[model samples]
Target chain A: MSVEPLNNELINNELIKYESIGISFGNRKVLSGFNLTVKKNQKILLRGKSGVGKTTLLKMLLGFTKPSEGTLYFRNRVIDSKTCWEARKEIAYVVQDTDLGEGKVKNLLGEIFSYRANKEKLDSEKLWTFMRELELEDNILEKNFQELSGGEKQRVGILIALLLNRNIYLLDEATSALDAKLKKKVADYFLAREDWTLLIVSHDKEWERDWMRIIDLETQSW
Target chain B: MPIYDISYTSLIFCFFLLIIPIFISRKIRLELEKSTLEAVFRMSIQLFFAGLFLNFIFNLNNGLLNLAWVGLMIFFASYTAIKSADLNVKKLFLPIIISIAFSNLVILLYVNKFVINLENLLDARYLIPIAGMLLGNALRGNVVGIGDFYNDIKRNENRYLYSLSIGAGRYEAVIPYLRKSLRAAIKPTLANIYSIGIVSLPGMMTGQILGGASPLIAIKYQITIMVAIYVSTLLSTTLSILTSFGTAFDDYGLVNKELYEKSS
Candidate 1:
């Protein structure tokens, strides 16, 4: 009974594992033999120069891009096309480009909430609160998403990620467009959540918290 | 009053009209002389053969032969739609053919049975021509709809991937794209329906009037045919998009890269 409980604890703590991951674009191998393990509630900030496959790593976790070599695991289960969908359910991903089409913000939000996994998660009160927290105006939701400024679009993307209420977050340049103050505020808000696992890819200084483990892709062994 | 056929001499005079466009092309450097002549020549030869074949089929009026001809039309329609949309014909052909055939048949049979009250449902006179109209519209719609859908997804891949990463299922993520493409597919049909008599007299109604039908009878057929064409176009476009979900997307719900024909 004691041994079983310890094994369960260990298994439960390890949220994600990248076993010797490699990514290649054609003949050029951008990333190779990279490995990382993420524990539950761990905050990891991935730093890399452009084209180092930082974004590719995040996408691989969602099965958007498959690793050229090695395997990825989520919650101790191998992340294949089949299991990645389930993994996506528990992960909130804020993409680098926040182009959600030309629809009105409210309609787009409604469409997102209408998904089967997100059906009951849309709370109007929370939406308003988050919007306010994110410095979004009341009339912003009525405006066309494409008409919004880059900062506003980024905030909206972050707002969506927060509203999803998922434990794991893959934030790719999620705050690049935000002003310094808003960026710090957003980073603080995300960092305050001790139980949230964050995999952030950004060049922002605001995300550099003492508790966050920073991994530089360039310095890592290929 | 019998409908007057174009005499060979008058047809030659009609061909003379092409010289004006050829002259304009040369003046404006449009460089379309070769293509224009080839298109006209191809249309004449194809339609000449079609007229002969259609006449033979009408005389026989066998239900099985008419269905086989309709099947052949569907096959060519599907092939053209895929080719026009720049999709791999081998991958998407089966689903597209099935969708076009199903939608056209359903609307055609319903029109024959309930609207026209035809004694012979598969009579070549009705089946072949009606099928041609329905299949033509559906083919155009499918080209627009399927092409827009896959192209939109490809262009805005980040948005689509964002949805998937946020816990959306394949259908959920694709619903927005589907809605947009379906609207695009049916927009022309809707415009044609609204602007029918006001903008131009439709070919079917004009043909019927020229063939000695009363204006009132031609207008009635025009209305029914317009409604039938609209319904079949919408149905086929919707079914084509849905059915293509099987082959166009892989197990990961990502569009198969191989589904697109590589541009030379």
Candidate 2:
């Protein structure tokens, strides 16, 4: 719910716009011609009930799913599977139970840092700074992911998304297991950042205050 | 005179051999008796029919007919490979067929050209049974290879997607699973190869000895057959996995949900 005020310098045109976006799973319409407009540096709260297509909408936006009809635009370009990476390069998504694979946590992070796309972009100092800011200790990264607590895993996922440096952040129940103090700290971290745009899917009322606008997806036809 | 047919009493005695296993299974509360019985019966019937057909084909001694019979064996072997692997025939049948044909032909021709040195390469005595044995082994190996690979990918899909997110191409992402599946499929054959001289005599060498071939000739044929099996195993495993990859994933290299078994 932490809605950072839109910074005038960062605000260019709309970062994303969904025009007549519709999606169906087999016979049922999960999202029916849904539309939303997101400007840069604005925090959007996507509140919805379970199975109301909140996850589906995010996947469609991420190009993992296709809209049966209508269109999606990202930075004024049509968004589809082919061009989804263009938006993905600027977007970071965090979800519960993010699969880390069979490896130590640090190895997973190392693989990401070694990726060709991020080889020149990631710096060791910045990764350490982000880890410290997120309150993640160094030893946790050395342990196997199977040994981690739920909160620790979630934080690791957050750290990964943070390292990606995508300007647009999509958080799907990202803080569900955190303590109230830590939740507020996380909310403030995103809210206080002027260069980031965020769309948050959450049930926590504490986050509501900082969000610029609240969009209730539950009331709409999915 | 009749090429050593089994007597009725011997057939009846063979049926009684099932009694020992059946009693043991019942005492142990094992549920495997039904499948064991069914498999034994099916195998007996199939082999009986195969022997009868081969007797006719051998007597006819026409090259075209012999070739057609070998073709039938390959077709049935490929079908059984698909069935036992529980692969969807429609989606994977073409790749399996192509891989089987490619691997078998490459090894079969190479062996004929260099090792056997028979003028009539398509001779029933030399080609049909040898091709059958080589293709049969390849089929079994591929069933395990392809099945394990697809199952591994399906089970670890989220991990696979994670690798893709970290900027791995599909092949690089899938290499771990492929290595595991190939090793699992080939390990048994490799072990058998190592155990050949020590543990047991191979069926081909034993058969050749019984057929009155010289021991030296029998050993050479046995060695060549093992070599062919090894080469075909390697070729088919690689070709089948790589060829099927094109159909298993979407255009973006993401796995297609429909291509994988629903249960897996």
Candidate 3:
């Protein structure tokens, strides 16, 4: 419960503003004249029907696509490609499909702490502890990644994001493949974290109960 | 006497021989007749034009004209390389051209200077056909190499991004794809070399023999050309793939979907 302050700080950040942002593909408009303002650590749930541009909004935020119009700010600072990379250090994104790399979970995990920027802060012990907490066995690290079940892959992806130590997490339907028990466990691990902020895109109402804000793509235009 | 002309009259008579296959195909209700006829016509037209051009090139025998002729071949080869490749042209054209030119030129010069020991390395009789052979084979290889590499990366975009996200540099991230595609592309050329005499009489060897050269000399030349083809194919494919990498990805090291012709 005390983690609520950290969530509030994230929600209060001045950079969390969206003005007139919109995107279109071919001739179809996904978003138009959309407006949003978010503060630090605020858990956000983005809900929409298929093809309503929920992914597009996230893509725009990640600099994968540019808005047809509108501006995005991060803590009151204008966000562009360069700033986005810098800000990305504070964000970890986990998509539903765990198709990130072509190696075992351990190899992928080893790569995170191997970066020059992260070299000074490698934490294998902490990662192993988290793996245990997530109910993953040490042997799971040795299994071939392509052979993992969807639930296992989802959990592994979360572990990767967690290892990155980013305060803000962008999760798109991350728990859809998980069983109920594991899903609840994941939800608690994230929502219960003291220093974390999450912007989650999901259709599962089960995972949204703890979210502080809900942005519906169906009702929000542009 | 000519060693083996397979004379004009015999060649003309050979057209009738197609009836054997056509008659058989008809019983099977296969519409192979039209396609066979189209293929025969295209082959005839192509060989006729190629003969005419070769005659002119040989007669002129000037180094500059021969080099220009080779340039035309490279241009055609590069065009096919880029087209067959799954890569986006806006990102791929320049590197491919450079690699094609570099590999072709280097082998062309080496073959001319060392193997044939011609007084003038660019002599038409020596340069034009050799460059054509080398560049032609390299083009086939580049198509596979360039095409396969990018397609592999695109197919495994998630894996690539995961590598980058986890702190692998761009080159390191893509090396796995590079190694796999390179092996696939080079395999055919390598197999051809290994099976040269046992499986098939290579075209250059057969041509030299028909032109009245001794079998020994023809075999030697065939061996040289095969080696040249191997070297140039490796050079061009690797160079082209590596050179194009910089343009194929965006600033974030993610492959730009726009660069590909359509999704691989």
Candidate 3 chain A — worst ten consecutive residues by lDDT sum?
A113-122
Tens-digit lDDT track of model 1 for A1-222: 769999999999999999999999999999888989999999999998999999999999899989999989999999887999998899999976787787899999988898999989998899999999999999999999999999999999999998999999999999999999999999999999999999999999999988669999999932
Per-model DockQ against the true two-chain complex:
0.84, 0.28, 0.25
Better of 1 and 3 by DockQ: 1
- Expressed as tens digits, the lDDT of each residue in A1-222 for candidate 2 is 334455433445588787887767789876676888888888888887877677666666666677788887877777765667655556787876676766798877776666666666667788788888778898887899878888888888788888787788888888887778877888888878888988888887767874378877767732
DockQ-based CAPRI category assigned to the predicted complex of candidate 2: acceptable
Off by over 4 Å in 1: B22-36
Ranking by lDDT: 1, 3, 2
How high is each candidate's TM-score? 0.96, 0.80, 0.84
Relative to the true structure, candidate 3 reaches a TM of 0.84
Candidate 3 residue lDDT tens string, A1-222? 999999877656744577888878888877788888765667777888889877677655555567888898776666785756655555677878877455776775665666654565547787888888778888998887788888888888888887777787778888899887888888878887756777788876666774367888798732
| Residues B101-216 of candidate 2: C-alpha lDDT, one tens digit per residue | 88887788788878998787777777788988898789888899988988887787766765555455557678777888888878877887889868988998887777777889
Off by over 4 Å in 2: A1-12, A23-31, A88-90, A106-122, A140-142, A204-211, B1-42, B56-68, B115-120, B212-227, B260-264
Interface RMSD after interface superposition, model 2? 2.6
Docking category of candidate 3: acceptable
The residue-level lDDT of candidate 3 at A182 comes to 80
The TM-score each candidate achieves on chain A is: 0.97, 0.88, 0.87
